[model samples]
Target: MSKYTTIAIFGLIAISAILYTYFFYFKIEERLPIYQPSQINPALVDPSLIAEKDHRISDFNLYNQLGDTVSLSDLEGKILIVDFFFTRCATICPILTSNLKLIHDRLPDGVHILSHSVTPVADSVSVLAAYAEKYHADPSKWWFLTGSKDEVYRLARTSYFACLDEGDGGYQDFIHTENVVLVDPSGRLRGFYDGTKEKEISQLYLDLATLKKELSKIN
Candidate 1:
């Protein structure tokens, strides 16, 4: 072969290797969908907030299992995962907690998990403390929150859009859902998953990693 022809063939081979590495080993990242208030179930959002494009998790105050107060302010500028459960739950709650534990174990810095007690009356600070211990949860990363039943339920339905059940946080109000909600660093709802399912929880982990990569770009 001619010298020039050999050089051209070598150049094409080098370009092919670079493209393969860029597309496979160094995969291009993607951003998770930012869920708008109107896109969520109508029952969970107020008519006014529905049309608002920048709806976020509203401010809230609840004490963690360790008796430390946790609020929206605490989670500001952090990626957060939230789920609703009661300590006494006998069915899917355990599975949800287990899956959450896996996610927490694999989490990177600046990520937090909040498990709010749906039965705040029964799941007091002391009860939550024991539950946290049972799960071997890292208090710094995972928080089991408990507060007035009304406050917890209101935040679940209105702010988190975490449950399909409707309630005014009244005496008879109760919520039960298998969903685990994801909130971005900006406090916008980003994704939802079935906490009780292993496959869905796996997807949550991947989405969380994607979110972290997206945030890293700005920092």
Candidate 2:
């Protein structure tokens, strides 16, 4: 082969290598098989049997970072990632939220992030606003939310399947899991993820992409 032909062949091989790296190996973590109703330890997911029966939590009043009450109904048709966190947290919250931002930045305009403050008493609207600004959260696409402590706790347990305990609002004040719950446009619980786990976080983002593709089939 001539030198020119060899170079052209090399260029094609290089392009293929780049695509492979971006898609299969380095870009997103490999997704593990999530426990579906058909293949789960029935006891843990039993209550969730009503999962398909129960509609997504659609209507509720919560304060946005701006101190204004906002309703989930206001965001009905968006692909939402709901996560529970606190401003005062010295550990997982920051890391989890940072990873969440990674997920948020990758999504298209129609997708959104709904972050709920676990320590609602301490993380008032103003405080949440500060946190949002500190993280440079996009107000249009991301909402830092707060509401009644009891209601927040209830939502954490029933909605995200996260933990929320009662206390004096200090260390061990709130009990909640570290997972990003993905919800569909019609408000179905699609996937739950370990928000702070780097591998899982990446997989969750890609799963959102897959979820969107599945959603498109219905339309």
Candidate 3:
């Protein structure tokens, strides 16, 4: 081939390679959707908190297992996973905690997990401390939280939409569910998983990794 012809052929080969990389190797990941109050099952959300769109987790002031106060602001700029359970739960709670432990082990720094006690009347700070210890949870990375029964249940049903039970968090009220909710650094609800199922937990890990990649592109 002539010199100009050889140069033209090389340019075409380089252009083809770049296009192939962009189309096949460099994929733009689809981010998890930001869940809105209306998108959630109507029964799971408190009637007062439901909005047309762009519903974010409400602020909360609750105590972790160490009796230290924790709030939504404390978790600002951090990815979070949240779940609701009681220390006394004997059925699926244990499985959920174990699966969460797996995520906690693999999660990147600045990622945190919050577990709220549904039966806070019985699960005092001491009880929560023991539960956290039992799970070998890292206090800084994973928090076992306890608060007023009413406040906890209100957050569960209104802010997180984590349970389907209906009640006022009164004396006879109790909430139970297997959901593990994923929240972004901006406090948006991104996804939900069945905490008791291994397959769901695996999917959560994959989604978490995708979230990490998404955040990296922005930063």
Candidate 4:
């Protein structure tokens, strides 16, 4: 074949390869699916269910600061503001926890705050207890949880519907956002906030108060 013919054949192959890869291998979700409890079951399921449920975070058994299991079911009747962080984190974790403390302080009795450690292996009950003390975490009110690497990642992504990727560091690694998840008394997700921002978290507090007003009628 002539040189021009060979060049033309190469260009076509490159285009075909690009098309194949685009269609088969590269699927990225721009945003997580929003899950409302009302959409739990249906005959013809909505297409968003898988995405939503996959990103939804729930209580898998995790050890709290005192080494007790704080299962998702255990939080069924109370309002919970959950987030992810690790004690050893030199970046965003401290800011998130300090902001959470403000929320914990303002929330009326019966409301709870939970922070799950993304560094699961390094944050066993004893390790987390030391970290919690550093934050002055009140075990009766705020719970700093630590568990297996798999369980923590599951909670961060599936339970809390926040980004905490293991790919950033392998099984012992986690990638995350500064998110504070607000779950209503009925286990329904109510709101989310940027844990690093005081204004946003303060707004979360106001929203929590509004939720408190509504939940009180049932109490």
Candidate 5:
């Protein structure tokens, strides 16, 4: 082949390699899905929101373990790992809390945990505070929240889509599930995992790493 022709071929090959690397990196690093209400099980979603698109976690005002009021705005620009549990539980809650504690301890900056109390009435700030302490949960990185039962239930059903059962958030109603949800900084639901499963937690870590890469690109 002529020298100029050989040089042109090499240039094209180099360009092809660079393009392959760029696309491969981006393919693996693409952001997780922004889960919509329509994408979730209808039973777990409020009927009013079943057809809604672009759904985000609704605003909330709950007291944390430290008795500080925490709202959705307070968590803006944060990647949130969220779950629902009550202070007093004998079965899966303890296991879920333990796993979440592991996540909380290892979370990087701009990531936080929001553990909402299913039984907000029984899980007052004092109760949540003790629970938080039992787990050595850092107040800055992990927040055990308790507030109006109605609001918490609403968020569980409509926003996070964390459980399978239906409830009105009434005095007689109750919800219990092991689902852990991940929310991106833009307030979109990105993932759901079984909090009691080790395999699921491992997957969560992998997804979180991917999400961090996406966030890094945006920032």
Candidate 6:
């Protein structure tokens, strides 16, 4: 090949490689998968919603640690990190709360944590208040919620899909899951992680950053 032709070919190859790298990284980093009921495990999803494609979390009314009524509307423009936990559990719940506290301390103002009490009947507003205090939870950033067991369980099964076993949220029914769910500002399910696992927590952090960038584009 002629000298000029060889140099031109090499330059073109270098430019092509740069473009490929740039596009590939941004494509992967800029988008997170929007989860739906059909995409989640069947056990986690209510049977009626197993085939539904455009599912978003349903509206809920729950009391926070301070006895303030919090509804889904109140969190309309914020990214949510949600989990189900009870204060009296001897297994997994403490670790979940501690790890979540790490996230709470590091997350920006736009992100909020909602720890719903699965045993809300026993976990009154005062009980949740003490639990929040134990974790040094910021009332503004992290909310420990309690309300009707039926409503909370309905959210767990139909909305967030955070657990596997099914129940009616009755007196004998109970749910215990370590799943940590991520919701976008618009209430779409984005991701799920094992709350007790460090690797999963790290992945949650990375996904949160990516979601923040994705939201930036829209706003």
Best by TM-score: 6
Best by lDDT: 6
Q: What is the TM-score of each candidate against the true structure?
A: 0.85, 0.73, 0.87, 0.71, 0.88, 0.91
Q: Per-residue lDDT for 18-131 in model 2, tens only? A: 999888766654333333343432332435443455545546788898777788778877888888888989899999999988876776757889998887878888899899
Per-model clash counts, in order, read: 0, 2, 0, 7, 0, 0
- Across 53-95, the per-residue lDDT of candidate 4 in tens digits comes to 3333444888898989878777667778888888788788889
The total number of steric clashes, by the backbone 3 Å criterion, in model 3 comes to: 0
lDDT of each: 0.89, 0.74, 0.89, 0.73, 0.89, 0.92
- Candidate 4 — which residues are off by over 4 angstroms? 1-57, 164-173
- Cα error, residue 212 of model 3, in Å, equals 1.3
Give the TM-score comparing model 5 with the true structure, all chains together. Answer: 0.88
Task: Give the per-residue lDDT of model 6 (tens digit) for 44-141.
Answer: 87788887778888999999999999999998899999999999999999999999988988987699999999999889999999999999999889
**What's the CA RMSD for each of the models?**
3.6, 8.7, 3.7, 16.8, 3.2, 2.5
Worst 10 residues of 5 by lDDT: 24-33
Residue pairs whose backbone atoms clash in candidate 1: none
Give the local distance difference test score of model 5.
Answer: 0.89
Per-residue alpha-carbon lDDT of model 5 for 20-94, expressed as tens digits? 988977555566888888888777877787777787788999899999988989988999999999988889999
Which has the better lDDT: candidate 2, or candidate 3? 3
Candidate 6 at 4: error in angstroms?
8.8
Better of 5 and 6 by TM-score: 6
- The CA-based lDDT of model 4 is what? 0.73
User: Looking at candidate 2, what is the lDDT of residue 167?
Assistant: 42
lDDT of 1 by residue, 1-219 (tens): 999999999999999999998999888668888988788878767676778878777788999999998788887788999999999999989999999999988778899999999999899999999999998999889999999888888778777888764668888788888999999878888998999999999999999888888999888
Tens-place lDDT per residue, model 3, 1-219, is 899999999999999999999989887668888898878888887777676477778899999999999889988789999999888889999999999999988888778999999888789999999899998899989999988889998888887889974888899888889999999998889999999999999999998888888888898
Residue 118 C-alpha lDDT in model 2: 82
